[model samples]
Target: MRTLTGREAVREALTEEMKRDEKVFLLGEDIGVYGGAFGVTAGMIDEFGEKRVRDTPISEAAIAGAAVGASLVGMRPVAEMMFMDFITIASDQIMNQGAKIHYMFGGQLNAPFVLRMPAGAAEAGAQHTQSLEALLYHIPGLKVVMPSTPYDLKGLLKTAIRDDNPVMFIEHKKGYGEKGEVPEEEYTIPFGKADIKREGKDVTIIATSHMVYKALNAAEELEKKGVDAEVLDPRTLVPLDMESIVKSVSKTGKVVIVHEAHRRGGIGGDIAARISDSDAFYYLEKPIKRVTGPNTPVPFSPVLESEFIPNEEKIIEAVLKITD
Candidate 1:
C-alpha cells in the first residue's frame, strides 16, 4: 500500500476512470486549469484535455443542467460545485429533473451523473460551508456518499461514477490535504457499508465524514479514562448500514452520533430513531447522544468557526455522560 492525500486519491480515481471509459468527463468552475478550488484535480486537465476536463461558468445551475442533460444522453458527467452552499442554485435541476427521471419515466431513463460537492465549515464563511448532505439525501432517487479517508474516497468515488443513478458525492474541505494509505492497485468500496474503526464495549460512536476521525480521537481519550468506545463510519447516508450500527449498539449498549452537519433535520435524528425502533431497541441502557453542529449559520470568525465544527472534546463529553 502507498500513501496519498485525499486530493490525490480523488484525482487518481477520476483520471483512471476517465481513461477507462470514454463517456466519463469532468466539468465545473475552476476545475480544469485551476485544479479545483481545493486543488483536488490538479494536473488533471493536461491528461484529459479541455474537452473532457471542462471549466464551466460560475453558474452552479448551468453546470448541473448540463450534467443532467449529458447523463440523459449516455454520458457520465462528474460536475463539481466549489462549495455545497451553492447547491441551492442547482437544486431544481438536481431535485426535479435528475432525481425524478428514473421514476417519472417509468424506469425507462436514468440520469447517471455525479455531483461533487465540497462541504464542511471552515473560515470559508456561512455560504461556502453548509453540510447539505442530509438535505439532498432526503430526495427519493439520489444516492449520497461521504468518504472521510483517502482510501475510502478513492474507492467509493469510482463506484459513484460507475453507478446508473444520479449520485451526490460530498468531499470534506478539511480532508482534502489529509493523507492516508491507499492500495497501488485499483479498488472500489461499496455503499451502505459501515467501517468500524475501533472495537469497544462501553459505547458506540457513529460518525460521518471527517467526524469519524474526531470520534476516533475521542475514543482514544475515553479509553485512558477507563471508558471503552467503538467508532463507526456510515459511509453513505441514503443506503446507511443500519445493520452494522445496530450490531455495535447491541454490543456496547450506549451510542453517540456525531457529524459536522447541524442537528435539525439532519440524518443524526434518523439514525437515533431507527435504533430505538429496531430489534436492538431493548439493548440500550441510556438514550443515544448526538454531538452535532448547532442549528445556525456557519460563523465567519476564526474562533467561532472552530467552535462551530464538532470536535473530539464534544465527542468525549457525550461519551462520558452516556457511559456514566
Candidate 2:
C-alpha cells in the first residue's frame, strides 16, 4: 500500500484508464501542459499526447457539448470544469443533451462521459466555491459521485469512466491534498455502496465528500464524551445506498446528516426524507438532525467562510442534540 493525495490518486486513475482503453480521453481547460487547474492531470499530456489529453478554450458549454458528442460515437470523454459553479454554463449539454440522449433515442445512443468538477469552499469566494452536488443529484439521468478519501477517489473515478451513462464526479477542493492509503493493484468501487468510516452504536453520521472527514473528527470527539458515533459516506449520491443508511440508523437509532451545501434543498434533506419514508423511521429515537451550511452564498472573508462551512464542531453539536 502507498499513501497518496486525492490529486495523485485521481491522476493515476485517469492515466490507467487512458492506457487501458483507447476510447478514454480527457478534455478541459489548462489540462494539457498546465496539468489542470488543480494539477490532477499533470504529466498526462506528455504520456498520452495532445490528441488524448486536450486543452480546450474557456467555454464550459463547448467542453461539455463536445464530450456528449464524443460519447455518442463510442468515445469515453472525461471533461473537467475548472470550477463547479461554471457547470451552470454547460447545464444544457449535461442535463438536456447528455442525460436525455440515452432514454430519448430508445437506448440506441448513450452518453458515456464523465464531468469532473472541483467543488466545496476553500475561501475561494462565492463564484468558485460551492457544494452543488444537489443540483446534479436532482437530475434523473446523471450519476453523481463525491469521494472523500484518496482510495475511494481512484476507485470511483475508474468506475465512472467505464460506465455507459453520464457521470458527475465531484472532487472537494479542500480535500485535494489530503492523504490516504491506496493500493498499487487496480480496483473499482461499485456505485450505490456506502463506506462506513467508523463504527458506533450511539449515533450515525451520514456525510459526503469533505464533510465525511469532519464527521470522522466529530466521531472522535463524541467518543471522548462517551458517545459512540458511526460515520458513513454515501460515496455516490444519485444511486444512494439507502439500505446501508437505514441499517446504520437501525443500529444506532440516531442519525445526523452533514454537508457544506446550503441547508435549503441540500442532499442532506433528501437523505433525511428517505430515512423518514423508509422502515428506518420506526428506528429513530429522535428527529433526524442536519449540520449544513447556511442558506447564503459563500463569503470571501476567511472568518465568515469558516462559519459558512460545516465542521467537526457543528457535527458534534448536531449529534449531541439528538443523543442527549
For each candidate, how many residue pairs have backbone atoms clashing (under 3 Å)?
0, 0
Q: Quantify how close model 1 is to the true structure by its C-alpha RMSD in Å.
A: 0.8
Candidate 1, residue 322: lDDT: 81
Q: Kindly report which residue pairs in candidate 2 clash with one another.
A: none
lDDT of 2 by residue, 114-184 (tens): 99999999978999999899999998899999999999999999999999999999999977899999999
Model 1 ranges with Cα > 4 A deviation: none
Q: Candidate 2: where are CA atoms >4 Å away? A: none
TM-score, one value per model: 0.99, 0.99
Q: lDDT winner among the candidates?
A: 2
